[model samples]
Target chain A: MLQWRNSLARHATRQSVSVLFTSVGRRVELMRAFREAYETLGLDGKIVGVDIDPLAPALQVVDHPYIVPRLNSPEFIPTLVEICRQEKITLVFPLIDPDIPILAANRTILEETGARVVVISSNAVALTADKWLTNQFFERLGLPTPRSWLPAQCDPDEIDYPVFIKPRRGSAAKSTFRVSDPEELRFFSRYVPDPIIQEYLSGPEITNDVICDLEGEVLSVVSRQRIEVRWGEVAKGVTIYNPDIIDACVQIARALPAVGPITVQCMMKDDVPHFTEINARLGGGLPLGIAAGVDSPKWLLAKAAGIAVDIPPLGSYQRDLYLTRFDESFFLTKDDRAQMASRCL
Target chain B: MLQWRNSLARHATRQSVSVLFTSVGRRVELMRAFREAYETLGLDGKIVGVDIDPLAPALQVVDHPYIVPRLNSPEFIPTLVEICRQEKITLVFPLIDPDIPILAANRTILEETGARVVVISSNAVALTADKWLTNQFFERLGLPTPRSWLPAQCDPDEIDYPVFIKPRRGSAAKSTFRVSDPEELRFFSRYVPDPIIQEYLSGPEITNDVICDLEGEVLSVVSRQRIEVRWGEVAKGVTIYNPDIIDACVQIARALPAVGPITVQCMMKDDVPHFTEINARLGGGLPLGIAAGVDSPKWLLAKAAGIAVDIPPLGSYQRDLYLTRFDESFFLTKDDRAQMASRCL
Candidate 1:
């Protein structure tokens, strides 16, 4: 039965193109979007998904899911290349921000294995990896950005209370804090690794997903006001149609020369967006944007097929639609885990 | 400014009816529903809400909010009654399940203070509180229920694997366990408080919000398939039009002699609903039922005013309208806390 299924999977991929998702942990919605766009276009496509954990829910939904070594492991890239060659993967992409920089650096190596990596330039990835550098880059481009200072640059006596202390390069808000006094600031600076103190910006946070083509031209931008966050990830978001945020996103993408989908995070203060972090990949809540009529997966698929991108002049999308998430568990026995784990090699 | 606000609050309640919400921790949506319904009815109804914590988000939204003593404290009932009389609160209700039985037992004591309590008889609350009794009662009444076994009665050698071990009287799925072996069952039985063994019913969990009049006649029952749960609470729920589940909810409400709004929990296995729980109060997901056109708050409001409820003959409601919940926040100051705390006295 296993051999028959593998033969069927190979037959299906032979008739169409294949896309790969790396470190695709619990990104079932993104995988579904690509599958849907492929089915709509009358193409039988297979998604080659990879995650370190065999229990990753995203792996369950894809055709060829592999359990590879951690991204930092020496064997990781080599194993990924072998899989790409074996699966005939045409387009390789990483959904996570941390994974983007690594993938971008190994773009040439991955391309040599017949699967071209779909990521922004390493230059843009480096700037985004560090929040402090991102603020400077955004400031130079005349974009609204949060005022930031390294921990070493702060003067205790004149420093403002109620400021944010965060890592210089962080994702998912790991080791982040809000300090109200000098004591807290001093404590968190030592507590958090590579602490970067930032001016407190209060109000609603908004995320904008900007799709740019290979030519570095913005195709469309969809912004949503993140109403709630659970465990430092967006839990509830509402699609918003704001011309100013959209314009800012387009300008930022052009300045950074980001290709494919690059999502920018901003917080609204005094009715103006202050760019906080830029992710050179799809946002966690990109499905909400897609549900609101933003066809991101379709654009990415077209690019992977080496087809020219075409985004219509009118980029209108549904607004005020709320996206709320909840947990769903998939049970796998011990034997199933063992089999999937070995399949990565 | 405090004195002026107090004077205005007294004036507002003096002109219209008042509703007291006890243990109103974070029920902002329920409070909003009442506020909107009151506004539409043109009755300047003031919500007098009380919680042990002054930082309760629900308190921040109401006109009269308080920090009361713990429910188990001797001062709780007296303090609640005094506030009801002083605030001229004509209706008193508790949202928390544990608080319901205590309030139900003190129903007449609360009524003596000219504030009618919105709760069923102590008998109904007692049956609903114990899962074992609930199943036996449902089974006796010809309603489908999961076969249950007392922990002491279960033999490890002969008991079925994949049984559920849960607290006989628990809320929010606290200390619930799904054991697939004898060792697992034995271990969980020791860990769980007041453990009761139940036959595992696999399928989708459906929650039905049933609103019955003061006479225990169910006016409407809105059932929904709980698509997902977050932290053991319904987060992503879609309205389900299951005639069997709806009919079962109505019959269960009548059998229990439950009044006002009672929510029923069931598992749909092979097209038949196995009743798991019968709560004699509105559920956490009642807003979904209301959004699906149940109008529970409206029905309860009419009962509070000693007015007869007129549920339409057809009870036709919007079907398949999805209700998604997200976290929202409320900020309060030190002074705001002090004033609301004092108002409870």
Candidate 2:
């Protein structure tokens, strides 16, 4: 046991060498941030991607890549465990929320195979993974949130008109719809078995990604106000920091130590923080967190491995950092428009 | 969706078929009682046996037998899920407590695959599966319980002399030990990382197995007091009903709707019930429960499959139910023993 402890300690002191064991359907932005975190940690290890999708961009820079089925498939976790065991993986991280519970359940078994499973506690993961549950937990903690109820539980006669119905377990504006009254609620409730009826909080939506240890100690915190989302993924965002919201995020984090990497999303209306939901894994604006001196991926990996995390000094980076996807449509030439029109014709 | 629901309803009503999923672990008795409950319900599904040991007696009645690895192993749940899916299993009952959490976690996925996963909610599962957590939850509800602390948090100064130390997550008294002082606690705590230290309550150790519906309504409640345990398995037990302890058991059942087919153990002393631990699955005296008339296994499976549970009326069955297992040593005949002794000589 002493020798094992000594070996672990020695491994921790060396430069950060990281591996990302992932599958298909991962958000591109978060994957990029993992690479940035590797750079931030001043480690020699590069991002290693594993996905069955041959076209996934993650395969481009990955030091090693393995083609595997989608993470939701039955073979995904067992295959990953086998790879981690054979490869002597130091840390196995999961990008998907559904995968979080499954991975956390295998912590001890994976650790026996010499791979540290760094996922949030199942309690924290469940509470944060489901958007409706996230709102309920925050309300219980006396945190501000948009008025929300399950469509089946809500009576339009009892509430204000013009409520919004959103998927109970998704991110961004995926499957979000505005409901005017009882008819719409009835129609949608039958269509969507699980959805939240939330009183629309009119304001720009912003998300704060806070990384904390199991004991609820915040290692680094960063926030980004979302400007646009096109297909359930963030299109653009601007980074900002609010101390009050950050403190609330810390409290929520402390309440859920099993939540390793999380994002507390809230809407700001007239300087009031109205939390909408929480994500148990990396949020869309993770790159912004990385740019703002929050090396979340490295800290998370280190923490899961039971290694001490030395977060880069907070003063080392700026807070106004931001990122945006550069679509070719933004700088289309006349020739491109002519070609597009010709194709349409 | 409408057609699917209609077909499900039709399938449930047209079949009085009974199917049994049995494990050779500690909950074998619980499995038997559940079978009796099905008989009372007029469900036709026959019980099936599953264990790595093919010689398990449950195979005597079950038409289909499956051999699998240990229930606590990581491969157990996934393998069971695969089998259930392929077989179009209506109700996949888990007789073991540790299997409760994993089953509950993947319930949605299992249900989607045409098998109804029956287990309590994750929160309730954790509370009942962990002895220390169950004690704390009961105490908060003002239920009677002996003093207890998690071994990691136990201090010699805090515990009374002659306390009981039990592993937080094991069953059948495999990891239970009687310890008197700090020296013993130190020695035992070294083996198990998170044992629960409890004030030794001297009384008849009684267990009440209750089957409840999703609405927290009791279908049947069978009581048993432990007679003896050898090599960490119940060797002998007899069923008896105590109105005093039964009342407390009812309260506990109502406290968690997620809890179904639960066996709660307590100490009956001075005509008072002192709660000890909760097993979310069937208990060891399940066969006794079946013999006494409240067949739990069948009823639990029926309810899990969304079939109506025909709970037998109270006092409909006799008490004094008994169950016993012979030790392997008892299997040797007199001639075999003599031959063995001669060989030794």
Candidate 3:
């Protein structure tokens, strides 16, 4: 039965493109966006959502939902490959930070099953994952970044009292602190693992959604100033057409050579975009970008299906578009849990 | 024209209830719930939403959205009183934390405008708002509470490592940290303003929605175990009917004499609910409680309209009802912003 299904999916690839989303945790909007894209483009495809947890919200909305092992587990890659092979997945997108490097590192192996993993290069991931290296990369690219230092290399006396200290390899603002004095700086430096201390950028933050084609050519850049942030995600944001921010994002995309969607974050210092870090996956606030007329999901879907989509020039999207978000729920029952668990790989 | 409209609203009060939600920042779901309740009950009343910011998301959905002064501003209470008188608002609900005490303190003044402020007594708000005082209150009520100490009262050597430190008066999990050692605790105690130190309850958290009538009668209690939390709000949760938790919540309501909806949060340690602080307003995750069949919005609206609502007895909500949430956006343009600003008081 599995062989027959796989053959059927293979035959359907000419008119359709099946996509897979890894670590599809709470990304129900992204799943819905892709579904809408498929409908709009008149393409037939299956969206397979995989996560370690069966109760993942995004998994409930996809065409196919499968439970996979944790990212660190040895069987994870193999399970993904089998799913791709079975579902005839033409494109794969990693939705979270940790999944990106893992998928990028195993890109060749994943693509051997005829699935194009949508990720940046492993080198780019390495440069972006570590906060210290990201600062260095920003300096190397002539992009202004917040002045950062290693704990041992910096003198407390010389450093500003209200500096920022965070883990060198952390996401979602975890274990981050705003050190007010020398005492806090010393305490948090030891508290956080592999800490990177940086001068606090006390300015409005800008998050840019930089979309690129499969060949790493920049397609569109949509910059949104974060009005409010919750749990490291933009809760309230407004899109702005700032030339400098757009240019900085375009420059970063060109330098890093990102594929698909990458989110570039920066803090404005004296009206200049001081680039912070690049997330190699689609951002949480990508919905706002799409709403502002970039239509990245549609563009990506069109590209994956080998259709010629009208590509707008960079920075051509809408400006002053505001976004305010609220949580919507999916109600599940015990019976649904049982059915979901039965589909585990 | 205003007097005529007020008279019309007064006439409509027999079959409808005009609610005023103060500081309606991001309670879009709550707004929608009240709207749904109005529709379900076949009522005809306007929902007036007030906020200091014109860009608040919840303001977009209400029948009448008015931008009010900041809570700390001198004009805030008078403006609200004027709005309540002009709009003929029958019931007033405060959405955010800071709005609660202000509304409670001015309840009589607001009620003189013929609006019933849905808030607890000022004493209850005072006890709930201060974490240190809440700990003492819990102990007095014979409830299990985490060992907490004021900054000047506690010894660092006597405290356990990995204890929690936070502002005595804080919300949204702001400025809270887990102190791993003596030095960090000492540093953070001074760092956080008016800090309280408590034993960190290393267990799953459960947020209970305890609904009460205007007479301070316990209507129903719905307890949900928080499977995941983001920005101090439940991202994923499952409704559970733990009788102990329900009893504890009932005990709390009885002791504190709560009015309307109050949220009781606790952490389970060794299978016992160690009560944490209380929020005198509706919980952020009240949607889950409504979905679980408590239907607090409908109940509140019906009660305000003098319509008979069939609220189930305590501990009668659905068990194992799961909720998983994602953000949905409201895309607004510059014109919308101008119009919203024009509605300011």
Candidate 4:
């Protein structure tokens, strides 16, 4: 830990590197991690958090808090570009799924503000945003993904029982169901929009946080076995140094040519990792990887500061590090609400 | 408030009041609220948190943390009784729904250890535990609840197209689905265990935190409009001064004779509150109510210590107070885990 500080100091004097996290909803831990990284590196930086909701908890803690229009609104991109320019944001990170595609699609316009947007390529986003496309991408890479089929491709009479069905493009485990019978599958297929069915792998699920450099080079892969999940976020998890999972995540990062941080989810079937989906942004549980010493935020800040970051080889993070989470609140008074609203573009 | 501190001090002279929170999984805020109450009331107390899972996040902050057998284990009650006697516990509160029934059933044995177990009667638990029974109870009290029927009573041909089917006894929104057609309802009725069908209320949902005295008299009712929910817990909520909701909650409290704090969930339809289900214990979002000035923890501790708590009238809490939540983690080293394990009973 001390080595990085000395290395950064030796390479350059204290520099300013402001970060902008878009759609920063309830990501207080991630924002704090970046703040700590700046402090540890002795860099002058400001963490700016922007969300559509004025009551977002993360906005309460950041150095700069702004309320932006909804992602679908036309003003969303312009507001983000303006914030990046005003804050002198050196690094831009999109925190939510729906924000990724938009940011990636407009990456050039945002980069014009002199900020290095940490988003995957539009091609990678297209492959990841839809579960059906993700399955095809995984298969094309020769990775073992769950056998999936679109609604029209599935034969109700011939399909096996107890499969999983969800929307072709969804997040936060919404509208996902474990269909035990063909009748249920047929009903849910119609009920859920653009449904995709996949074989249910009744084994432990692992979430891999893959860190890549700005050049899209895979640096480290930290595998965490999800113990308990609440609302699609990991409530309890433990870091595991499984070579299979690590290698599979590295392969996925290389295939996607992912920039910054991306999360690859999979389920273990008889000790083999079967890919599920890839989130081309920081995972909700990325804090665990940082705690295990992968330190993606520190590395990202170091790279942005033009300081060489000494990232370890893959699967080098501390294993068996357990993480349990509980809800913490930020109480907003009338004045606080008004102050946040005033920052709206 | 200073009023409570003076009143508690006048009645009791720096008394010790130890609190035991059962199944204390991810209730770090609740535990901290009780700790703050004790400090404000000038009472000496130890907060004891027990969970079946050793990695429970709340355990990391309590004054005494212990691991116990599962609620179904025959040794569960015996272990709890032993801990209460050992720690000289003054008040007991169960944090989860399943734990409520077990603790209510074993209230006599637990209270025999000179601790007042803050649980409602077994009848109340039975009425609240089963969704079907809860609907019946609400209707019997002349309260407006969503029209509901057990799977056996529902005729597929006569039922409405859009409705909800969930397990007859379930919590945390598990296995709950909105059926849009007869085929979907028929499939889900068989899919969900002991399914009950209810009219799907289309309006916004509201959760009321009702605080009652030891004698089962309602003191305060705090209603919060659920702006957003994640995993059945309120993520973004705003306190609302809905008189109809307040009166309905007070009526439900009087009918059930709630002993301590209970949560009443409902959805508004055409501006009328239609009751859903009642949880016969403190709500997960009770912290918002406390912050809004209900202060149930302080009231409970004051009552337990024989102090006259100056609780205002029903619906007295500050309205329009917003609450937003984010996950916070507790990191346990290997040594911390071993220390917690050694305290297991």
Against the true structure, whose lDDT is highest?
3
Q: List clashing residue pairs in candidate 4.
A: none
Q: How much does candidate 3 score in TM-score? A: 0.95
Give residue B320's error in model 1 in angstroms. Answer: 1.2
Using DockQ as the measure, the top candidate is 4
Could you estimate the TM-score for every candidate?
0.54, 0.43, 0.95, 0.94
Candidate number achieving the greatest TM-score relative to the actual structure: 3
Give me the TM-scores for chain A across all models, comma-separated: 0.92, 0.80, 0.95, 0.95
Q: CA lDDT of each candidate?
A: 0.78, 0.64, 0.88, 0.88
Which pairs of residues have clashing backbones in candidate 3? Answer: none
Q: Which ten residues in a row have the lowest lDDT in candidate 1 chain B?
A: B325-334
Candidate 2 Cα outliers beyond 4 Å, as residue runs: A1-12, A24-46, A214-216, A298-317, A327-345, B1-345
* Candidate 4 deviant stretches above 4 angstroms: A1-15, B1-14, B159-161
Tens digit of per-residue lDDT, candidate 3, span B159-202 = 77889999999998888888888888888888899999989999
**Model 4: chain B TM-score vs. truth?**
0.95
Ten residues in a row with the worst lDDT in model 3 chain A?
A: A6-15
CAPRI verdict on model 1? Answer: incorrect
Candidate 2: CAPRI quality band:
incorrect
What ranking emerges by DockQ with the best candidate at the front? Answer: 4, 3, 1, 2
lDDT string for model 1 (B104-195, tens) is 98988788888878788898888999999998999988988887898788886697778988999998876676787776676567667888
Supply candidate 3's per-residue lDDT for B36.
Answer: 98
